[model samples]
Target: MVIGDGILTPCISDSIVWISAAILVGLFMVQRFGAGKVGYTFAPILCIWFLFISGIGVYNFIKYDPTVLKALNPKYIIDYFKRNSLDAWISLGGVILATTGAEALFADLGHFSVWSIQISMCCVVYPSITIAYIGQASFLRKNNDLVGDTFYKSIPGPVYWPMFVVSVLAAIIASQSLISDFLHNPTIPLSRVLPLCEIVHTSPKYAGQVYVPEVNYILMLACLGVTLGFRTTAKIGNAFGIAVVFVMSITSCLLVLIMIMVWKSSLLYIIGYVVVIGFVELIYLSSVLYKFKEGGYLPLAFATILMAIMLLWNYVYKRKYYYELNNKISPERLKEIATNEKICRIPGLAMFYSELVQGIPPIFEHYVKNVPAMHSVLIFVSKKSLPISSIPVEERFLFRRIDTDGVNVYRCVARYGYRDARSEEEPFEKILIERLKDFIREDLAVNEGERLEAVAREIEVLDQACFSGVVYLIGESEVVAKQGSNLVKKIVIDQAYNFMKKNLRQSNMMLDIPHARMLKVGMIYEL
Candidate 1:
């Protein structure tokens, strides 16, 4: 593991961090174009780099002491422990740092296809890294005094400058990939503080590449902070090793479960696998934990805080959803309100946004109670994101007319795939009106002359309403814990969740609704 520390270390400095800081800023700035484009730009450079190291490794292996090959024997691992014991055990923290950002490569599999990842890792990465390690070991053994800067000193002279540039680029690319892994202090504040919107489809071809501008900046700042704080590869390697082992151990535990529960392996085989892999991970875990005061506690703190936030968010989310579910206005109640002549019918078109898919939201009741009148053409628009990529534009609007007494009330489900960008403000209303007109034509097509006349009249009303104006009505509610709630629940809802909600993307901003024509109906949710 120690042998894989550097393909070519560039004498990363403690005193001068601005160079690294600049590289990080530049790396994160390009994230708006997404990983696919970034990958395309950097892939060739990385391939060349791997090949260079691999070639250097092979050259050094033949030229230097061939006796170093004996170190490949498994006995050396056991012998090293016997010789140094506690010191060797402590060094496992640094040794494990060789695999830094490797787990991130696996986590970032969503940015690429399965076959591409497999081919690249197997054909290029693993082989190149192994050869580079062998070469470094052979050269270091031959020139024992150059052990301090193993990778750089071992490199052939003509390739040294190129290696330095490539190494820095490699580090940048690596940290770019590591962006998805959020650290605690920065992550919590950024997420709860910044009003950043998540841009899902940064690349038209890649659905999984998410670009949050605020997150990118926060991560950049965090990288700069970490770089400025630790100031060297050796010190930061403490955190790096912990992060790597945490991922590896979790992955192994999941794999073990899969092998036992899903694969239904034999008892003896399960025991063997657990004993071997578990022991190795525990060994590294303990070593990494020893450096907790140095840096290892970073990930641990991040996990604890993130987990708490998630749990609190989820708890409130479920309760609030159910509250909306149970309190949704039934069809009969909708008809009653629509038929009520005292509830004055206004002229323009009103689109009320809601979360409930089936029935009218409780907020509708709140709106009608406070406000005496509603628009002539009412639509309960619930924007839905399906678990897929890119819903077709023509099929995006699903118009279902509600049987509200003599009123043109509709339940318009604006469906979008997860990767689909929300439609523009003007087009959204225009498309819905057009789709509603088409829906009326289709429904009345199956009816008689009187129905056809009604259809024409309805379309005329819709057109007249559109020409008058379209107003987006949404309930902007303050979510809070009920009066009788416990202190913890109150804190979760009133403090943390509310803080996040306040800073999160606004509904009008999210839906691209025009602020001039938007009416915010405020209410309170005591969950």
Candidate 2:
């Protein structure tokens, strides 16, 4: 909408709206090629935007209203509030838009260094925005008739067209940052935090730089819908203001928690921080809330829907994890089953993908109990998510032998960082086999003199068996309400959870396992 307004002011054409939509669609369409390709192009344009605005601000500040500088004094703010209390407070909703890109700067910290951001904001962004606002106030003081389009009308005739072009470019660049953050940030309940799309990391150097084709198209369609629906920048600005204030208020609350828990700050410092920031945010929040009937309800409605989805997913996942924790079989039980002579031993290898790092998964026990037979080599592989950016290759897999009985049973834990890419080129089975081979070689080397011949023969037999075939077993578990449960539990577990599970990507597809050699052990969990 900002871009459309910019173009419409300078170009007197009936098709400007369509042109703006086309440009917005084009911006999203190029996202699949990755942000790194075009991110550098925005820097120079943004620099020019800041410089141009600062120059105009200085010119207007000197010529129109030198006395407008006195408005910066806090005394005037206090007097205005004293005279028109509620009106002054309601205008804060508009005041907060002046710092519009602050949150985006914080979100982009993963792409750039903290020092770089600090320097840019202090030297470039802060001074430019302050001067631009003062100049706009000065211009409005002299010419009240130009209040509707103060920004463009205040510009000098010679540079008006060029400034309009710059404004359009700036708007597009700002919108790009917002869309990128929405799709990339895992904390936002849009892409990674929800099962809305598959986030594919395009840059090996920067894990935060991702490309989500599904989200990109969805956002583009949404942009077009809003552009056609609202058809004016004023209504869109109201929605945008609500979104900005909500984000600021949420950030302030999260910051208070972080300072206490992560920073371990003093009580006095925490109180001071909250009092200062909380006061400002509360005023803006109230002001935006007051405008709920005038388009502010849109963002609040969207947030409510997103929050419900994230909470539902988290609830279902917790219930499933609790079930696994209670129903897991002990290692002794697995050993006894492996040692049982009555049960037949199959010829090939079986890799059971489980979530539990300790104890055998209930799916494995359920399978063997029904079949009364197990593979010659059984591996319980658990893929664990770590809290770091990337895990070292050498520390990727932790292999431990469970028993040395009739069938060689082992447990393998594969560690991955949240930011790490699960490359589809390397199948999990192939990686597991390579790690197992490495484990055998290390074992043989460690016990070179004690059981050299026995270890060599065992390695040869295991190699032949692994080469013969490998099967992947995964649990296709569903959460359901227990018998005699209440309606809410049934609706949440049996209806909502099951619906999401059926739509979300399956474990085998996510792990890149071949469908032909995969076996799904279906199970039901009543919680």
Which pairs, if any, clash in model 1? none
Report the CA-based lDDT of candidate 2 relative to the real structure.
0.75
Candidate 2 lDDT score at position 201: 65
Q: Which stretches of candidate 2 lie over 4 Å from their true place?
A: 1-17, 187-193, 385-394, 404-406, 416-431, 444-450
Write model 1 residue lDDT over 59-177, tens digit each, in one string: 89999966787988999999999999999999998887666656555455667778987887889898998899899999988788987789889889999999988876786666555
lDDT of each: 0.75, 0.75
Give the clash count for model 2.
0
Residue 209, candidate 1: how far off, in angstroms? 1.5
Residue range 172-240, candidate 2, lDDT tens digits = 777777766665545443422365456666565666677877667766776776666667666666677
TM-score for all predictions? Answer: 0.90, 0.90
Report the number of the highest-TM-score candidate.
1
With a 3 Å backbone cut-off (N, CA, C), the pairs that clash in candidate 2 are none
